[model samples]
Target: MLSWLAEQRIQEAMRNGEFADLPGHGKPLELEDLSGVPEELRMSFKIMKNAGILPEELTLRAECVTLEELLAACRNSGNANSSEQKSLESKLSLKRLRLQQLLRERGLENSSIFTEYGDQIRQRLSGQE
Candidate 1:
């Protein structure tokens, strides 16, 4: 019964684009239609997607970094070849560094939040378990 409910929800989410999934591969979440979530929360999801989960085609190495770190990384990863992206990357690097420092200061650097960044990012940023 519960599984059926879960499946129904998944189907509904699929229709609504509220949830996205990859099967045996990384598929970019179609976040364009997602609504209700705050803008910052949505950004967190992008960070989660970039750092840990690569789009199935890219297959970037899996990472374990907080959403902030991922966001920072994404900002830094602004396609170096693109001048505009390079500028964004520079900004991201600075923000990423600051978050890293914050994590260290809070002593959460070595904690599960940092160690399990990818998973936590998925859960927290995506509002999923």
Candidate 2:
């Protein structure tokens, strides 16, 4: 009932030209590029972005960068135990895979980072142990 009343008021206002002469009245709305957002989450993410929130995939990408840094540190550390270093490397590889999956889900399968990480993983699997 309230929605009907509100819509009626909006229609009346439109009839009165209340929305006319507004900014961009004769122009098309400038829409943001949401091609990287998943179809189901696109609307939710738009609202979240309007409220100054980052999307989950972006946060996951940040985590991937941190993990990559930690893995590099382990690789360069003389005092790091081989087993511990290997564990961190494994975790980093898994995180990269997860990030790639997220990117693929969001229609970013062609993203450079995804391609790079995916290629690395494939190359590692194809190499002789």
Candidate 3:
């Protein structure tokens, strides 16, 4: 709805000579529901949170960057850089956020995955369980 409205506004502004260059109309995007993510992945999210991000804001979607990817992104620079570890922390944190987001949407998960993960999951979710 916002995208359509923005488009209309842009068109009107152009017709009225009220605008020459348009600011970003912004990319149209749908907020994905992460509630359906598998239990294992959510556990991974918890792992990320343990590393430091607030889980609630990130959501449980696996679409977020993974630990492996973070390592690679960090390594893209020829020389091994200490900053890579820090980047890993940020990625893990976001993944945890996704997990927390999913947990909230599901209204509290009682999956065995959490049981298996045990303390690690709890620690990451900020005592959300």
Per-candidate TM-scores read: 0.32, 0.45, 0.29
Residue-wise C-alpha lDDT for candidate 2, range 1-129, written one tens digit per residue: 999999999999999999998999989999886664445667887899899997665655656666666777877888877887778778777877887787778777786654554455444444422
Order the candidate numbers by lDDT, best to worst: 2, 3, 1
Residue-wise C-alpha lDDT for candidate 1, range 20-62, written one tens digit per residue: 4546345555545334333444576567677885432112112
**Predictions in order: lDDT:** 0.51, 0.70, 0.58
- Whose lDDT is higher: candidate 2's or candidate 3's? 2
Model 3 ranges with Cα > 4 A deviation: 1-65, 72-79, 113-129
How many residue pairs collide in each prediction?
2, 0, 5
Q: lDDT score of model 2? A: 0.70
What alpha-carbon RMSD in Å does predicted model 1 have with respect to the real structure? Answer: 14.6
Please list all clashing residue pairs in model 1, or write none if there are none.
26-56, 76-89
Clashes of 2: 0
Q: TM-score of model 1 relative to the true fold?
A: 0.32
